[model samples]
Target: MYGLMINELKNVLVAFICTWGLQLLTGITVRNPLTLLYFALFWILGRCKKNEKYDDKKGKMADILWGAASIILSGSVTFFIGRKAVLGFDSGLFRLVGILIIFAGMFLVFVRLKDLPSLIKNIFSKDYSFLAVKGMMQEEKSRKELPFSDLKVLGISAVICFLCYLPYFLYEYPGIMTADSLVQYEQIIGVTPWSNHHPVAHTLVISFFYKLGLAVTGDINKAISFYTVAQMIFMSLCCGAVVLRVKRIVGGIVAPVLSLIFFALVPFNAVFAVTLWKDVPFAGIVMLTGCLLVDMAQKDRGVWSDLIMLFVLLVLLSLFRSNGWYAFLLCIPFMLYFYRDNLIKIAVMVAASVLAVIIIKGPVMTSAGVIQPDFTESLSLPLQQVARVLVNDRALSDEDMELITDVIDTTYIHELYAPDFADNIKELVRAGHPEVIENNKGTYLGLWLTLFAKYPADYIKAWFDLVGGYVYTDFPYDVGNVDGIMANDHGLVPTPLIGGKAVIKGKEILIKLGSFVPIYGMLWCAGAYTWLVIFALIAVLKNGRNKKLAVIMILQAAMIATLLVAAPVIDFRYEYAVVMLMPLTVSICVIIKSEKTAKEY
Candidate 1:
């Protein structure tokens, strides 16, 4: 009895520490009342029936991994966030204490998990294809017939998305043209040099519409507005297609209705739909590609057109952004594995896509003289790490100083060393003898590796400062407020068509509410979406036989992985693809897994 009481007390204390750590790690106010709720929840979980009789060594690995992830992740965020703090305790020491508490919290979580993993074994083990994705290939009849036809499903969903997006379009007329959009516009007008830095394919797409709009309207702003409206329609159709795909897979009006609500009402979708970013179209194709993968995997053989569509989309996917190509490449193995039943056709399509991408990106771009992005673009992590070492006055060998100064002027570093952003330092490299490191690849690699070994703690903090937002839920990214075009030198700016006090304030209220609203804002949260995807994947792994549903998720996961390694900015738009497909991901995982699947797994 005494032991149990002591254990409970320890659990409560651990819960408080982790709860506070999480609030701080996520940039939440330390004084929020929500900590008490989390503390109570953890205590209740700890007090639940505790037994480990059923779990095996294999399941223990899962617990350990989760615990280790919690410790490391929390520790990382804690260290990075506190780096600039003036607190008396050393930032490193504070991080160590935070990690210790987070570890204890993970212990409580393991206690809550109990022996469920071992119980998962019979726990209803069966043909997983039947159990996991039973709803995928066929449609179950509704208790009452759904009135909507297939075309109606597509049209209805599309119209709803467009209409929902209309307000954003009207609010920020001519579209939200930021720095990248302005650059694209300059390239379109022949004022700036052509470059694949902003994908030629995407630039061409914009060029087509803007030129057409000019011919029709003879007004640059109108042309831009025309492009925005057209983009909204195109993206709406894409989202509608996503909704239709999800509805068919889940079967019924309820799923479609809910999906419509998510696609239409979510501010991220609306804002992104009208935004003049290449990623908007890229995300659309990504979602469609995911849907197609789902369709092909759910059947023995897909329609004949699936191959052609796959080829075309893959080419465009590879062309839309550099990262898109890499992400697709990363998923090829997984795609082959999950959709192996249709191996020959899938392989042919993928090979063709790869060839097409190579041809376009290589000979085609070279012939067109589109300048590729500087090589320094790929060295975001290493650049930030080196800069951190310089900024913090860490001891460095003369050779290290020479190597860094060869690429970056240390004098400018004080002004350039932003903890989270790498662009300034990257520019510094470009400003210096940029090709020095590029030409000496082996030398640079050795320098990066050696520096990492020397400044392991600084390296970790530098990386976490940039990437922790994606892993920490409620990381305070403002998606809804990025409504209007930024000030641009090009003849591009916001020409808002709708603005009375009510309309403007209503939009303000929406954006402001998202900042403080608890669950609602998660629609725009990278970490929330990431965690949700992970949970769905776990569901698939524990219960599902074939991995089609899980395979489709690789689309988002691959893109996100690319971002983690090389993301320049922790912008909401970068992670929007995950948010776009999350509803479908959750729906499929939920439908496939049974009541017993949850109980056992």
Candidate 2:
């Protein structure tokens, strides 16, 4: 009893000190709410291993690894917040000591994670009692399950989604178009040469609707409005599909109702639905593709119709964004691994999709005089790494200097250096001397490798800065605040149907809420969604009942990995597919399957 009491006292000290330490690491404040959260986590973790014992050698190694991981995550979040907040972090001994204490506390929490898989498996057991609701739902399929019919429920959800987005569309009327949108519009209207930098397929999608509206309405603004309305309808239907699918899988109204709220009422979703970005449609299609994959996987066999649909979707997915194609190709291996029987059909669809992309990108684009994105677009990481070495004044050999000079004028390096974005450096290359690097790839590649070998630390810092926002959970993003299209000469402008301070404040509050609110704010965070995907994958693996869902999870993860490696900005729209996949990922936990299906994995 005395020993237990002493142990309990020691744990209390650990938890308190850790909580205090985390507060110091982030920011020392009297009433920082995160302090309470940290303490509770530490205390609970301590309780988890109250009497646990392990081999001294293995236990020491495990503790070291987990401790290192915890510190990295915590340190990344701390450093990112510091840089973004622009408050110079105190490099004091107290903060250093605080980090040490934090590591110890966070180690306690992570060490307890060893039991998480078993805990998840037990909680979401193979029996899947939650899914028994499906059988009851099947019995009542003919009968009106709720007061309203299922079709009516679906319509209600979609309409609500449309109606919620109506205000944003009207307020930022026609649609919200960033620089990329305006550039695409220029390509569409012949204001400039057509460039496939902003995926020509998506540009054509806008042009189709815009031109149709122009013919009917004879006003450019109204024509753009036409595309916005169509996009809203499509996105709403996607939300409706989510609602119906969630209802079917969970076999309950509660989960579906909540899912509807998430899809329809979230401010970011509404803003994105009306935003003229390729990512918007790409995200919408990713969800649909994921849903289709889930449906096909369950059948354990494929038909010709399924192959055709998958082929079309894969082609559309690829054409929507260049990265989307890479992600699709990445997913093919996982698909083949799990769904081996359907491998031949999957391969054929993928092959055909690749051929279509090639034809469109090569012959069709070339024939139409559409310019493709420059090779510099794919060199973001290497360029950034090289730029980092220059900006930091890292030691460079004469050969390294010559290689960089060949790519871009060395005099412009300081002026073009942007630690978090590669565009400026890329632009320098484009403006200075792209031809030299383009013509002498081998020399530059050697330079990049040599610099990497010498200044690996700088390369790591450059990567972290570029992608830190996507790695830190609470990183702030101002979504909906950037109202309206960029000032354009083509008569493209915001024609807000409503105007007032109240509307302005309402939008501001909604956008700011992401920073002020806790769980609700997490919805807008790409990093939070990234962790959600990781957690969902863990749950699926532990329960071992949703390998098909796991396939989709891996696909989402692959897409995120692509973003990490080559993404220019840590934009919410870029990671929006995983953000929108939240409800679907949750459904993976409760997907109904027979004993045979579960065992097949």
Candidate 3:
């Protein structure tokens, strides 16, 4: 009894320490006390339920109610707090308090109302039918004969991935034409070797190649070429890794071949792979992380090693883009569903990840002074001036206009200064213009609203428009247009026979068609319309099944749905990273089904 108490205390201490350490490093305050309080309450409730005099069936009912309530309440609180924060309300403190109160009230109600568990059990008893289904699945797997030729499938996948990216080494593909790419290149080649706007991973990769190229050819262009080729090779290897993992799961050679074929044939994949953009790499890391997670779920041995790999992959993924932070959210469903039995371990892992991000982005860079911004005031002055103009119905003087432009240009340079608030403000002013400020404000608000509303269809349409606008105009041939052709306003170029139309029209048609067809397009969309049905069936049929797989599917669905709404006009380039996830998921699902079928036979 004493040992158990000590262990529980130790676990709680570890979670608290890790969370606080990360908060300190990141300089973010958890203003909501209720958040912590709720967690405490939940912990206590769980402990009490475990120690109750009730039988296993009764206690299980209590656990289920607790879980269901937690999910609903957490979602509600997150939604409200997120909205309040976005709208400029300082609700963090209140949110914390409210969560605590809610949790406390719920805990008291559960304690006082002993019949609550029975009520919940009556309401949710049907849900347990899924467990029986899952038991059958396990039995099926046990009865199946293990296949012998799986290794050959993995080998073939490797060969296919290698061949797909070979052209990138032999020929130059004009990289992703984004403002961000230019900034990344500058950071890599510049003497300072850092950019506040860009993440560290891609720049680091580029710098390594630059140095290597200088050693060999002594030409800057050659070095960039080498870097680009290397990035392509690495991306190709990621594709190969996904294919191999898929083969392992599916128990057939076809899965690997299909994954390779789908990946290679994707127009955006081909374009992004040949470029110096980080999207492909980011996608690779995410896929790799997913593969590792699946492995950890299946095999209980060496879990620590698998977890370490996940941590490293997450760090790398985070460094790929500012939005890369969202990738961490993937773990949420996994914890809530699959890792429920290991709550303490999950909490520790989350805390560790938060700390890693803070250390990488904060103190490490702070010591180097690479994040300071000057001209921040100048940047803000224009926004104020622009607001005055708009509100007062006055035109800006030519001098004011010029100052605003100068401020916008210089803001980027000023952001290089780290940790110094004054310098940071100055740089912000220099890099900002009235129009830029307005656009940013609008973009953020739009994104926030879209996510809160969760309108998946509207989100998908907007994303398509954004992609069409960016890629077709920037890189014509990737969408099946001829090279050297200039795309017009709608990302279409005039052709001798076709006159002028969007370059992506053809690609878009195929994407739409493939999305409906089985084993093609992105599996998420292919399965989107039927998602609720599929999920319902899985929940009922697969008991104690690999819960991680189901959680991943849920996360992916949520991510894609969020992307559909919140993503500022999408470019095919941005979509490139997420596209890899779909094929890999499909491969896993197929593998699971095949294994089940074999077992039944």
Which candidate gets the maximum TM-score versus the true structure?
1
lDDT of 3: 0.49
Query: Where does candidate 2 clash, by residue pair?
Result: none
lDDT of 1: 0.74
Listed per model in order, the count of residue pairs whose N, CA or C atoms clash below 3 Å is: 1, 0, 32
| Residues forming the 10-long window of minimal summed lDDT in candidate 2 | 127-136
Q: Rank the candidates by lDDT, best first.
A: 2, 1, 3
Per-residue lDDT of model 1, residues 1-601, tens digit only: 1344456567666566546545434445332336546665555444332433327988778767876765565456545554333243345755565455444444444444443343344236742231232232223332233478878888988998999999889888988888888898999898988899888898998898999999999989889887888889888888888887877776666677788898898777787888899889988888787777677667767576987887888888889988889988998998788778778878998999999888888898899888889898988878888888888899999998898888777997887788878898888888898799989999988998998999999998988787767776635456756768777766566788889999987776666545533345556568777777778888776776656778767777888888888987677778777778777788778566544344454
Tens digits of per-residue lDDT for model 2, 406-486: 667778688778887888888888888887877888988888888889999999988877876676654545655678889
Please provide, for model 3 over 263-286, each residue's C-alpha lDDT reduced to its tens digit, 9 standing for 90 to 100: 666554555565566666777777
Provide the global lDDT of candidate 2 against the true structure: 0.75
Q: Compared to the true structure, candidate 2 yields what TM-score?
A: 0.77
- Tell me the RMSD of model 1 versus the true structure: 11.4
What does each candidate score in C-alpha RMSD?
11.4, 10.9, 20.2
